[model samples]
Each structure stands twice: as C-alpha cells, then as structure tokens.
Target: MIRSTRILGLAPRVAAARATALWPQLYHERVVDHYNNPRNVGSFDKNDPGVGTGLVGAPACGDVMKLQIKVDDQTGKIVDACFKTFGCGSAIASSSVATEWVKGKQMEEVLSIKNTEIAKHLSLPPVKLHCSMLAEDAIKAAVKDYEAKRAKLSPSKQRGSGGLINFIGDKAAIV
Candidate 1:
C-alpha cells in the first residue's frame, strides 16, 4: 500500500512537469513579437491604379483586419502586401501570415490560399479560429479591390467578374 501511494504521487509530479514543459506550445502567446507585429497598419491612397485595399472585421469578437496589396497590373502579380490588425495576438499572427503569403504571389495564386493554411502556419488555437477567417477575408477583399481597378480601366470587359463571384462565395461575403 505504501508503494502504491508513492507511485501515485510520483505519477502526478511527472505529469505536472510534462504539462509545464508543454504549456508554451499549447497556449497562445499573448505578445506580438516585432516580426509577428502587423505591419503597414493603415490605408494608403488606393485610388492609384496599382493599389488594392481591403478592410474587414468581426463584431462578435471585436476584431478588425485590414489588408492591402500593390500589384503589377500588367503582369497580374502581387508586388507587395501590408496589413493592420486589431485584436489578440492570434489575430496579429494571422494577419502577419496572410501578408507574407500574399506578397509576390500571382492574383490567382492568392485566391487558392486558405485560412486553414494560415492558421496552421501560425499554430493558432481553436478559440482564435475567427482570427484566421478574418485574415482570409481581408485577402479576398484586397484582391477584389485589385480586380475592380482592372475592370475600371477596361469597363467594357469582364475582367473582374470571377473575382466578384468569389467575393460573395463565402460565409462572410460582403456585398
């Protein structure tokens, strides 16, 4: 009986040690490191032909996300991306990941990218899942802005129709 009691106590101690060691991996890091800080956090003059800007938010969680891209209109390629995010660390991380993923990508390529991929890259917790969703929406919004510009330059063409379809293709599709 003494041996059994000693074993039981030792097991809990071992378990606690393991839990402590894994805590950082399991919990969301609350602070945004400089690298993870959302950069380009404000609007530029998107009226310029090559600029694309997107703004989005979730009222339920009180999270707001904005993303922008500068594209080479001739090549249909993204030349740069920037983001500003308001929320927890996870939101910041998601925006950071989204900006990295969108920059230098072809417009078509950015469309294929997924929120789950951003979440996976950041190792986001489930409770922060909405943050990833916001990132994805922001990307799509920026792309729509780019496509809209493309359409405006050649108003007689259907250049942005597919993108317009994509705009309303998801759960949070903004009209």
Candidate 2:
C-alpha cells in the first residue's frame, strides 16, 4: 500500500512538472511580464471632470476590465491612465498595455488605437484575442464617458443637441 501511495504522489509531481513546462510556452514574454508585473493597475475617480472611466466585459470569457484616463483639461491630452481588470492573464496584460499606450496621447489619438496592435504587442493567441478587444472597447467607452461628462458640464459649448464632438481643436469633428 505504501509503495502504491508513493507512485500516486509521483504521478502528481510529474503532471505538475509538465504543466509548469507548458506555462511559459502558452504565453509570450511580454504577456508574462505584464501579468507578473502589471502596470497602472488601479482606478481613477469616475466623477472627476478630468477623468474618464470605461468599464467593459467579455461575455464569452466573463472577463471584466475597467480603464480610466485623466485628461489634461487645457491640452486635451491624457495625462495619466489606469485600469482594474478581473480576468485572465491576457486580459490583465491587455489593460496594462492599454493604460501605458494612452498616457500622454490626445483623446483622438487614443481612440485611434486598435485591438490588433495590442494583440500583436502581447502576442496573444487567437483564443485570447477577445481580451485585447475588451481593452479597446474599454478605451472607447472611457473616452465616450469623458466626452459625455464634458457635454453635461458645458452644454453651451457643445454644438447641436446630442452626439459626441471633438473639443480639442477649432473644428467640431462629430464622432
């Protein structure tokens, strides 16, 4: 009986070793780095006029990501960015990289960012591509929230009745 128990314990150890070996192969170096040391893992005040908050989720994976940006009121540039994600490593890494990319970028520039770019940067697999898409949706939602808040605060400044418009330059580019 003791001999049989020892063999069963060894079986578990062998399986664990195999899993450990496959772990590194499953995720790219950048994904692993971000997962281990995620950057901008926090939240900003959603009610702050200069802050925009975006909360998005993937129904397929039940992954939720909240990304926020603190924009410079004067320059219309994202002065800082942060996120809080409750999901897998890929989702966390996607949000972490999203925050990093948005910092110091103007609102329009930030909106132009694509999920494919994020996916490529993280080398996320096809199955994990939705994680990057979640990040992208979060960014767009946050920017939309920011614009909505601004519109509510300054209705007179807003051209037309409803709809988002770019307030950075002289041209009122409708979004």
Best by TM-score: 2
Q: Which residue pairs in model 2 clash with each other?
A: none
Candidate 2 at 87: error in angstroms? 0.5
lDDT of 1 by residue, 1-175 (tens): 4346344456867867876666456654522442345555556677877988889999988999888899997788888888878776778778887887887889889988888987777667787788889989999999888777866775444443233322332332211
Q: Give the distance in Å from residue 119's predicted Cα in candidate 1 to where it truly belongs.
A: 0.8
Predicted structure 2, TM vs. truth: 0.83
Q: Give the residue spans of candidate 1 off by over 4 A.
A: 1-42, 159-175
Model 2 stretches astray by more than 4 angstroms: 1-21, 159-175
Q: Can you write out model 2's per-residue Cα lDDT over 1-175, one digit (the tens) per residue?
A: 4346344457867867876677679999999889989999988888899899999999878999999999998899999999999999999999999999999999999999999999999999999999999999999999999987888887545746656665655667665
Quick one: best lDDT, which candidate?
2
